[model samples]
Target: MNLKVSKEAAEWYKNEMDLKQGDYIQYYVQLYGGIPTVHPNYSLGVSIGKAENIAIKDVVEGITFYFNSDDAWFLEEFDMEVVFEKEELEFIFHKK
Candidate 1:
Protein backbone atom coordinates (compact mmCIF):
# COMPACT_ATOMS: atom_id res chain seq x y z
CA MET A 1 0.00 0.00 0.00
CA ASN A 2 1.36 3.45 -0.96
CA LEU A 3 0.27 6.26 1.38
CA LYS A 4 0.75 9.87 0.37
CA VAL A 5 0.07 12.93 2.51
CA SER A 6 -1.00 16.27 1.16
CA LYS A 7 0.86 19.37 2.32
CA GLU A 8 -2.39 20.94 3.46
CA ALA A 9 -3.26 18.13 5.79
CA ALA A 10 0.34 17.69 6.85
CA GLU A 11 0.42 21.20 8.21
CA TRP A 12 -1.99 20.25 10.95
CA TYR A 13 -1.47 16.53 10.98
CA LYS A 14 2.30 16.80 11.32
CA ASN A 15 2.26 13.08 11.85
CA GLU A 16 -1.30 11.88 12.06
CA MET A 17 -1.69 8.68 10.06
CA ASP A 18 0.11 5.37 9.97
CA LEU A 19 -0.57 2.45 7.58
CA LYS A 20 0.69 -1.02 8.30
CA GLN A 21 -0.13 -4.58 7.45
CA GLY A 22 0.26 -7.01 10.27
CA ASP A 23 -0.72 -10.58 10.88
CA TYR A 24 -3.57 -8.88 12.65
CA ILE A 25 -5.52 -8.03 9.46
CA GLN A 26 -5.33 -11.65 8.47
CA TYR A 27 -5.98 -12.94 11.94
CA TYR A 28 -8.78 -10.50 12.51
CA VAL A 29 -10.71 -12.03 9.64
CA GLN A 30 -10.77 -15.24 11.59
CA LEU A 31 -12.11 -13.50 14.66
CA TYR A 32 -14.45 -11.41 12.43
CA GLY A 33 -12.62 -8.17 13.00
CA GLY A 34 -12.10 -6.52 9.61
CA ILE A 35 -9.79 -3.56 10.15
CA PRO A 36 -8.70 -2.81 13.66
CA THR A 37 -9.96 0.59 14.81
CA VAL A 38 -7.44 0.73 17.61
CA HIS A 39 -4.09 2.17 16.61
CA PRO A 40 -1.65 3.62 19.07
CA ASN A 41 -1.22 6.87 17.15
CA TYR A 42 -4.41 6.97 15.09
CA SER A 43 -7.43 4.82 14.67
CA LEU A 44 -7.28 2.98 11.33
CA GLY A 45 -9.55 1.31 8.83
CA VAL A 46 -9.55 -0.02 5.24
CA SER A 47 -11.74 0.62 2.21
CA ILE A 48 -14.02 -2.27 1.51
CA GLY A 49 -14.34 -3.43 -2.07
CA LYS A 50 -13.59 -6.43 -4.23
CA ALA A 51 -11.03 -4.09 -5.77
CA GLU A 52 -7.72 -5.76 -6.53
CA ASN A 53 -5.82 -3.09 -4.63
CA ILE A 54 -6.23 -2.50 -0.95
CA ALA A 55 -5.43 1.14 -1.52
CA ILE A 56 -8.50 1.32 -3.67
CA LYS A 57 -10.30 0.61 -0.50
CA ASP A 58 -12.13 3.56 0.95
CA VAL A 59 -9.65 6.28 1.79
CA VAL A 60 -10.97 7.30 5.14
CA GLU A 61 -11.85 10.98 5.43
CA GLY A 62 -9.21 13.15 7.13
CA ILE A 63 -6.62 10.36 6.90
CA THR A 64 -3.57 10.07 4.74
CA PHE A 65 -0.53 7.84 4.63
CA TYR A 66 2.52 10.11 4.93
CA PHE A 67 5.13 7.86 6.46
CA ASN A 68 5.59 4.29 7.42
CA SER A 69 6.27 3.15 10.95
CA ASP A 70 9.35 1.08 11.64
CA ASP A 71 7.34 0.02 14.65
CA ALA A 72 4.28 -0.33 12.39
CA TRP A 73 3.62 -4.00 11.74
CA PHE A 74 2.72 -4.72 8.13
CA LEU A 75 2.13 -7.80 6.07
CA GLU A 76 5.24 -6.75 4.22
CA GLU A 77 7.46 -3.72 3.72
CA PHE A 78 6.41 -0.94 1.30
CA ASP A 79 7.27 2.52 0.08
CA MET A 80 6.10 5.78 1.73
CA GLU A 81 5.52 9.13 0.05
CA VAL A 82 4.17 12.57 1.08
CA VAL A 83 2.02 14.41 -1.43
CA PHE A 84 1.58 18.17 -1.37
CA GLU A 85 -1.84 18.35 -2.97
CA LYS A 86 -4.60 19.91 -0.87
CA GLU A 87 -7.29 17.68 -2.33
CA GLU A 88 -8.56 14.46 -0.91
CA LEU A 89 -5.86 11.86 -0.27
CA GLU A 90 -6.19 8.41 -1.67
CA PHE A 91 -4.01 5.39 -0.99
CA ILE A 92 -3.05 3.24 -3.94
CA PHE A 93 -2.18 -0.29 -2.92
CA HIS A 94 0.05 -1.87 -5.48
CA LYS A 95 -0.22 -5.59 -5.42
CA LYS A 96 3.04 -7.16 -4.43
Candidate 2:
Protein backbone atom coordinates (compact mmCIF):
# COMPACT_ATOMS: atom_id res chain seq x y z
CA MET A 1 0.00 0.00 0.00
CA ASN A 2 1.10 3.54 -0.71
CA LEU A 3 0.80 5.95 2.28
CA LYS A 4 1.04 9.67 2.00
CA VAL A 5 2.39 11.88 4.77
CA SER A 6 1.22 15.42 5.40
CA LYS A 7 3.49 18.38 6.19
CA GLU A 8 2.27 18.70 9.74
CA ALA A 9 2.62 14.98 10.36
CA ALA A 10 6.08 14.98 8.85
CA GLU A 11 7.16 17.97 10.92
CA TRP A 12 5.76 16.38 14.04
CA TYR A 13 7.60 13.19 13.23
CA LYS A 14 10.86 14.98 12.58
CA ASN A 15 10.58 16.76 15.93
CA GLU A 16 9.76 13.56 17.77
CA MET A 17 12.24 11.18 16.10
CA ASP A 18 15.37 11.05 14.02
CA LEU A 19 13.73 10.32 10.67
CA LYS A 20 13.71 11.65 7.14
CA GLN A 21 11.35 11.66 4.13
CA GLY A 22 12.13 8.15 2.94
CA ASP A 23 11.85 6.61 6.40
CA TYR A 24 9.02 4.21 7.21
CA ILE A 25 6.53 4.95 10.01
CA GLN A 26 4.54 2.59 12.18
CA TYR A 27 1.05 3.52 13.33
CA TYR A 28 -2.27 2.07 14.54
CA VAL A 29 -5.95 2.93 14.46
CA GLN A 30 -8.74 2.47 16.97
CA LEU A 31 -11.44 0.02 15.97
CA TYR A 32 -14.75 0.50 17.70
CA GLY A 33 -15.70 -2.87 19.08
CA GLY A 34 -19.07 -3.01 20.85
CA ILE A 35 -22.82 -3.11 20.41
CA PRO A 36 -24.36 -1.34 17.44
CA THR A 37 -25.21 1.79 19.43
CA VAL A 38 -22.28 1.79 21.78
CA HIS A 39 -18.71 2.83 21.11
CA PRO A 40 -16.07 0.16 21.47
CA ASN A 41 -12.41 0.20 22.33
CA TYR A 42 -9.78 0.19 19.65
CA SER A 43 -8.25 -3.12 18.63
CA LEU A 44 -5.11 -2.34 16.72
CA GLY A 45 -3.98 -4.52 13.84
CA VAL A 46 -0.76 -4.11 11.95
CA SER A 47 -0.85 -2.74 8.38
CA ILE A 48 2.00 -1.75 6.12
CA GLY A 49 1.94 1.36 3.91
CA LYS A 50 4.26 3.99 2.45
CA ALA A 51 4.78 7.67 3.23
CA GLU A 52 3.92 9.97 0.31
CA ASN A 53 5.75 13.21 -0.41
CA ILE A 54 2.87 15.51 0.54
CA ALA A 55 2.51 17.91 3.46
CA ILE A 56 -0.11 17.28 6.13
CA LYS A 57 -1.65 20.70 5.57
CA ASP A 58 -2.08 19.92 1.91
CA VAL A 59 -4.01 16.92 3.01
CA VAL A 60 -6.84 18.87 4.63
CA GLU A 61 -8.57 15.69 5.71
CA GLY A 62 -5.75 13.18 6.31
CA ILE A 63 -3.30 10.95 4.54
CA THR A 64 -4.95 8.70 1.99
CA PHE A 65 -3.50 5.67 0.23
CA TYR A 66 -4.41 2.78 -1.99
CA PHE A 67 -4.26 -0.78 -0.76
CA ASN A 68 -5.37 -1.63 -4.29
CA SER A 69 -6.70 0.00 -7.41
CA ASP A 70 -10.23 0.33 -6.02
CA ASP A 71 -9.54 0.43 -2.28
CA ALA A 72 -7.95 3.21 -0.25
CA TRP A 73 -7.60 4.33 3.36
CA PHE A 74 -7.06 7.55 5.26
CA LEU A 75 -4.86 7.68 8.30
CA GLU A 76 -5.71 9.50 11.52
CA GLU A 77 -2.36 9.20 13.22
CA PHE A 78 0.91 7.54 12.23
CA ASP A 79 1.75 4.59 14.45
CA MET A 80 5.26 3.52 15.50
CA GLU A 81 5.41 -0.19 14.69
CA VAL A 82 5.02 -0.23 10.87
CA VAL A 83 8.37 -0.89 9.34
CA PHE A 84 9.71 -2.03 5.98
CA GLU A 85 11.08 -5.55 5.93
CA LYS A 86 13.93 -6.52 3.61
CA GLU A 87 11.43 -7.72 1.04
CA GLU A 88 8.71 -5.13 1.74
CA LEU A 89 8.25 -2.28 -0.67
CA GLU A 90 9.10 1.15 0.70
CA PHE A 91 6.17 3.57 1.15
CA ILE A 92 7.19 6.96 -0.10
CA PHE A 93 5.61 10.32 0.77
CA HIS A 94 4.29 12.72 -1.89
CA LYS A 95 3.95 16.49 -1.56
CA LYS A 96 0.53 17.92 -2.21
Candidate 3:
Protein backbone atom coordinates (compact mmCIF):
# COMPACT_ATOMS: atom_id res chain seq x y z
CA MET A 1 0.00 0.00 0.00
CA ASN A 2 1.01 3.59 -0.54
CA LEU A 3 0.20 6.84 1.24
CA LYS A 4 0.38 10.42 0.10
CA VAL A 5 -0.46 13.76 1.66
CA SER A 6 -1.03 16.99 -0.20
CA LYS A 7 0.85 20.07 0.93
CA GLU A 8 -2.40 21.87 1.66
CA ALA A 9 -3.65 18.94 3.70
CA ALA A 10 -0.40 18.77 5.63
CA GLU A 11 -0.59 22.45 6.44
CA TRP A 12 -4.15 22.07 7.58
CA TYR A 13 -3.21 19.24 9.91
CA LYS A 14 -0.25 21.12 11.34
CA ASN A 15 -2.42 24.10 12.24
CA GLU A 16 -5.52 22.25 13.37
CA MET A 17 -3.62 19.71 15.45
CA ASP A 18 -1.07 22.24 16.73
CA LEU A 19 1.73 20.00 15.52
CA LYS A 20 5.41 20.75 15.23
CA GLN A 21 8.36 19.18 13.50
CA GLY A 22 8.79 15.44 14.17
CA ASP A 23 5.23 14.99 15.43
CA TYR A 24 3.43 11.85 14.28
CA ILE A 25 0.02 11.57 12.67
CA GLN A 26 -1.55 8.15 12.74
CA TYR A 27 -4.22 6.78 10.42
CA TYR A 28 -6.24 3.77 11.42
CA VAL A 29 -9.44 1.93 10.64
CA GLN A 30 -12.32 3.11 12.75
CA LEU A 31 -15.22 0.78 13.32
CA TYR A 32 -17.87 3.47 12.85
CA GLY A 33 -18.98 7.09 12.42
CA GLY A 34 -17.18 8.32 9.33
CA ILE A 35 -17.93 8.30 5.63
CA PRO A 36 -16.99 4.91 4.18
CA THR A 37 -15.12 4.48 0.99
CA VAL A 38 -12.94 1.39 0.66
CA HIS A 39 -14.77 -0.61 3.26
CA PRO A 40 -18.39 -1.18 3.97
CA ASN A 41 -19.48 0.14 7.36
CA TYR A 42 -15.94 1.16 8.18
CA SER A 43 -13.96 4.35 7.92
CA LEU A 44 -10.59 5.87 8.56
CA GLY A 45 -9.60 7.73 11.70
CA VAL A 46 -6.72 10.07 12.43
CA SER A 47 -4.88 10.87 15.61
CA ILE A 48 -1.61 12.26 16.94
CA GLY A 49 0.40 9.36 18.25
CA LYS A 50 3.57 7.31 17.87
CA ALA A 51 3.72 4.37 15.50
CA GLU A 52 4.67 0.95 16.81
CA ASN A 53 5.09 -0.65 13.41
CA ILE A 54 4.76 1.46 10.35
CA ALA A 55 2.95 -0.13 7.43
CA ILE A 56 2.59 2.86 5.12
CA LYS A 57 3.77 6.46 5.63
CA ASP A 58 4.32 9.87 4.15
CA VAL A 59 6.20 12.88 5.41
CA VAL A 60 5.22 16.42 4.61
CA GLU A 61 6.22 19.71 6.18
CA GLY A 62 8.30 17.85 8.76
CA ILE A 63 5.38 15.83 10.10
CA THR A 64 5.25 12.05 9.84
CA PHE A 65 1.90 10.57 8.87
CA TYR A 66 1.50 6.81 9.01
CA PHE A 67 -0.57 3.72 9.43
CA ASN A 68 0.53 1.12 11.92
CA SER A 69 0.97 -2.53 10.97
CA ASP A 70 -2.28 -3.55 12.55
CA ASP A 71 -4.23 -1.45 10.12
CA ALA A 72 -2.55 -2.93 7.07
CA TRP A 73 -5.52 -5.05 6.15
CA PHE A 74 -7.68 -1.98 5.79
CA LEU A 75 -5.27 -0.44 3.30
CA GLU A 76 -3.66 -3.43 1.65
CA GLU A 77 -5.64 -3.21 -1.54
CA PHE A 78 -5.48 0.51 -2.07
CA ASP A 79 -3.26 3.54 -2.24
CA MET A 80 -4.52 6.35 -0.04
CA GLU A 81 -4.20 10.06 -0.49
CA VAL A 82 -5.15 12.85 1.84
CA VAL A 83 -6.09 16.22 0.43
CA PHE A 84 -7.50 19.54 1.61
CA GLU A 85 -10.77 20.36 -0.12
CA LYS A 86 -13.97 22.18 0.72
CA GLU A 87 -12.27 23.42 3.88
CA GLU A 88 -11.79 19.89 5.16
CA LEU A 89 -9.46 16.94 4.82
CA GLU A 90 -10.62 14.34 2.33
CA PHE A 91 -9.44 10.79 1.78
CA ILE A 92 -9.07 9.43 -1.72
CA PHE A 93 -8.47 5.74 -2.28
CA HIS A 94 -7.11 4.17 -5.43
CA LYS A 95 -7.54 0.45 -5.68
CA LYS A 96 -4.27 -1.32 -6.20
Candidate that scores best on TM-score = 3
Q: What local lDDT does model 2 show for residue 86?
A: 57
Ranking by lDDT: 3, 2, 1
Task: Tell me the deviation in Å of residue 89 in model 2.
Answer: 27
Better of 1 and 2 by TM-score: 2
- What Cα-based lDDT does every candidate model obtain? 0.32, 0.36, 0.88
Q: Which stretches in model 1 have alpha-carbon errors above 4 Å? A: 1-6, 12-71, 82-86, 92-96
Model 2, range 34-78, lDDT digits (tens) per residue? 212111354333233465433322221233322322122332233
Top-lDDT structure, candidate number: 3
Q: List residue ranges in candidate 3 displaced over 4 A.
A: none
Between which residue pairs do clashes occur in model 1? 21-74, 21-75, 47-57, 47-58
lDDT of 3 by residue, 17-62 (tens): 9999999999888877764667988888889979469878999999
**The CA-based lDDT of model 3 is what?**
0.88
Clashing pairs for predicted structure model 3, backbone only: none
Candidate 2 Cα lDDT to native:
0.36
